[model samples]
Target: MRLLMLGFNHRTAPLELREALAFDNERAAAALHELRQRYPASECALLSTCNRTEFYLARPIHDPPTIEHLRSFITQQTGADADAIHTASIHREQEEAATHLFRVSAGLDSMVLGEPQVLGQVKRAYELADGCGAVGPVLHRLFQGAITASKSVRRQTGIDQGRTSVSSVAVAFAKNIFDHFGDKTVLAIGAGEMIKASLASLRRENPKRLLLINRTQQRAIDLAKQLELTGTDHGGRAWDDMDSLLIEADIVVSCTGATEPIVTESRFKPLLKKRRGRPLFMLDLAVPRDLDPKIGSLRNVYLYNLDDLQQAVEATTSGRRELVNEAEALLRGHIDRCMGEIRHRDIGRLVKQLRQRLNDIAQEEQGRTAKKLASLNGQSTEQAVEDLIAQHNHRLVNKILHLPLSQLDRSDPDASMGFYAAALRRLFDLKDQPDMPMDEASSDT
Candidate 1:
């Protein structure tokens, strides 16, 4: 079977297109089912997230589907047109596909380089596909190898060593504004992972109080309960009370899923008056942003969005670039170790069997020649024995060389086969070298 990894990622596609094709883990199994139905002979797995949507497939070797066919399948399923898929997709087969997946699982291919979330995302997608019977031998091997490489990268390199992700980076930025977090009231908007991650960072600071307001009441309550149970001062309220809470909060972090700004210039302009000129820092981590762009222009207001945080992210990434080289070396070591083990097992067995077969044929031919000489010529025992031994040795040498010569004469060769052929040439004195011996008999007529 041939492996195929086809996908559109943040580097290739815009955020709008990526979000349009986003699929959560809860829907992953169903997506795998759809993929299997479309290509029954193939084994498939789907990985989707905010930045990427990828299909890892294994097709029958003889009649594999084209890259265009896979792209069309995605376009039809995701409601994207041909042009949208055309500019934002790449397909890699076999070795290249494996390498791409290794880099992805290592977080090397992430929008935020070396971010830990992408590996977990891939693990979740892989588990769901396997649970749904969509993953076969090749995919299981492929993902397990990738996961193993990811683990090595984490342990062997410093690429993921610092405060990573937008949430954590935003929290780092917040520290620069506020001298101490213990006196601050941190208000978090929405119940999405961005807020959850921000809460994690804020909790680490031991903030005086935590406030949560989500569109869903229970979600806010759930987060509040979780924070309270973890020994953090916390409370939750309906979304309507958000404006009033904003007045009390020293720092506000919001990442909601609204298409438009939830906190506009008009809405927030009045809150500034009630606050009595207390400097407030707001971190907007949402895509399409929860806070209005003009909010940054307000007096005594510090606002930072995802775009503004690129300098910090780039600084962090630049530090990790050196570690990336070490991590890549570790990953290649793993791949080579695995491929070498498989090659040894398969080729070692074949070599053993072929040597045994050649020995049997050589012994049979030697017996036939000895019997014919005894039957027809009636030669003296000593001379006949000597002739038979010399001829048998010559025949064995010629027979062993037949296949090697055939392989060497081929104009083009498979990579694996060519390796073996070159090895044979070196093993015997077969190459055209100054020190090589000629194939002349030691004892002859």
Candidate 2:
């Protein structure tokens, strides 16, 4: 088995490049379908968020996909600039890929360290890929192991002691902007988990008004009820009225699942006159960015995207240094265990192939021997003699398999069993060659 991971994160790429490559749920599902079409024998899962966009793949070691292929695929799917993708990409293979994923799932690599939201994001990504039938044994095992490691870290350490998510950091930024929210009108666009988390954090600040608007009004209404925003100052509003609400909003947080910008310069430029130059604090927390980049240029507007919030969140990583170290150690242990399991699984596949090949050979020879004996005797064999012959054939096959099976089972830390497995495959011609005809391949016993 071989694993490949190629993508960019907040540390390696700018927000513009990351946003250009980010995949929402629908886009991610479609990309997975395309990947399957392009590489049927391979497995893939895509994990895309505001801070990162990653593609994880599993293929036969002999049939690996190159970094260039992944770059081309992502560019084609997202229509991102090829040069930007190439410049910002970070590639990992085999165990390194596994380790990266483990760290990501456990929130060790998040912009806000030990953030709980990324673990859920990882699970959602795995579920989405699995639902699309893009995940096979390798990814299923890898993601599940990563999730288990994440849960273990959360349970074992105090890494999540204080405000530790992007939403919380956004809230912190809001607080720094305003001494209090009593006089401010807070308008949150879209009702995703991140928006809800941000709103929840803001609710504690006791904003004068909280308004939520979503493309699907029902979701906004449901979220409003869940957050208990039943008062006159807080409630769910219709999508058609969002523009008017935006004009009145003093603090705006927009995080939607939209693939394109919802608030553009042209749309908001006309609304600026209605606000009469009142300061607007807007946060665009969505991955394809619900708010347009050009809107940040407008006067009397303080705009912040994910990258800006990342800078502000970095300073809040105090008091968790020891916990972060402990989490990393735990993640390393998990990575080692996961890699060991993958190796065993790979070896098991080879062992099964060898056993089936030997069994097929034995069965074919036994059939030939029985036919020859019958022809020589010119009579059918008795049940007792047939049973005796079958027992003798089983004993002979076991004797032939014993030495190689024993060698495979030998534990040698200095030696790689992969070498032995590859030798066995080459020696027996057990794995079909690339040039071999499909119909001519030996049938499994």
Candidate 3:
């Protein structure tokens, strides 16, 4: 089987493109099924997140559905422009595909380098595909390897030692402003993922209270329940109560989906007197910015947007460059080991085929010998003698295989082993099995 990975990530595509291609769990499940239908024997998975949308496929090396076929499928599925996708996406095959997945699972390709969430995301994607019967042996091994490699890299390197996520960085900045969250009230104004992540990071500080509010009050309540924000002190509140809550809130994290700013300066400036000059730290993690830009001008209002959070993340990442290099090397080693195992599996299959072939030939020759002996003597040989002859043939076959089998057992499961397996297959006239493509475009349509 050949592996093919095609994707658009933060570095390769704009947010609009990523958003357009993004798939929720239900959509992802449906997409996997559709991909299976389109390429009946192919194994497929779709991984869609805020900053990326990737498709990983494993199929016969000479299959009908190639990279272009997959691209067309995606275009039809998502209604994205073919030319735009072609320009923004990347295509990788075989080892390159595996390498990219390893990087992604390890958060090397994330906007916030070494972020932990991508590992879970990768696992979830794999599970989703597997659940839909879109995963086979090749994908099962590849994804499992990626997940394990991610863990190994994290355990071996300092890349994930500190706060790496944007949400965590925002919380770290909040720490710089406030000595502690023990007496502080944190009001999170949204039920979106950014708000949820920010709330999770903030929860570690054990804040005095967490107030959740959304345009839809029930959504805020549902979010509170999902986050396990129990107790009367940490619960959802009405959107209309936001103004009153703002007076008591020491920190406000807003990441709503509104096209315009949710907290305008005009609406918030009058509430400042109620605060009595107390500092209010605000983090705006929304795409269009939930907090108005002018809110930063207000006295004692510390406003930081997504760009600010990204800067903090970048600063943290910059200091870990050496650690990242170490992580990269670790990932490469894991990939090598994984590839070796796959090659070893191929060799094992070939060996099984060889053993079966030899056994079939032995059985055929035994029947022929029995017929000739019976004809020569004009009587059938005794059952005991026939059984003895059969035992001898089995022993002879085993003896013939002993040296090669022992050599194969001792051989390292590396490129050299792959070469040996190929040579043996050719020598024995065994059925040809496709290895992962060597050429970058070998699996192209």
lDDT per residue, candidate 2, 1-445, as tens digits? 7999998999999988887888878889999999898888899999998889999999888874677898999888878889988989999999999999998988888998878889999999999999999999989999999999999988898676574678777777776677888989999999988889999988888899999999999999899999999888898999999899999999999999887899999999999999999888899998778999888889988889988988887777765788888988888888899889888999999999978987877777677667656665645558756765787677667767777766787575655678877888988889745875656666531
Candidate 2 pairs with clashing backbones: none
Candidate 1, pairs of clashing residues: none
Find the candidate with the highest TM-score and give its number.
2
CA deviation > 4 Å runs, candidate 2: 358-445
List the candidates' TM-scores in order.
0.66, 0.81, 0.65
Compared to the true structure, candidate 2 yields what TM-score?
0.81
All models, RMSD in angstroms: 8.5, 9.9, 11.6
Model 3 Cα shift for residue 48 (angstroms):
1.2
Query: What is residue 85's positional error in candidate 1, in angstroms?
Result: 2.8
Query: Please, what are the lDDT tens digits per residue for candidate 3 over residues 17-42?
Result: 76577787898899999889878988
For 375-410, candidate 1 gives per-residue lDDT tens digits of 756556877777877887777777777766667665
Worst 10 residues of 3 by lDDT: 406-415
Measured by lDDT, the strongest candidate is 2
Stretches of candidate 3 exceeding 4 Å from the true structure: 171-186, 189-196, 200-209, 214-233, 238-312, 346-445
Model 2: how far residue 186 lies from native, Å: 0.3
lDDT of each: 0.79, 0.87, 0.84
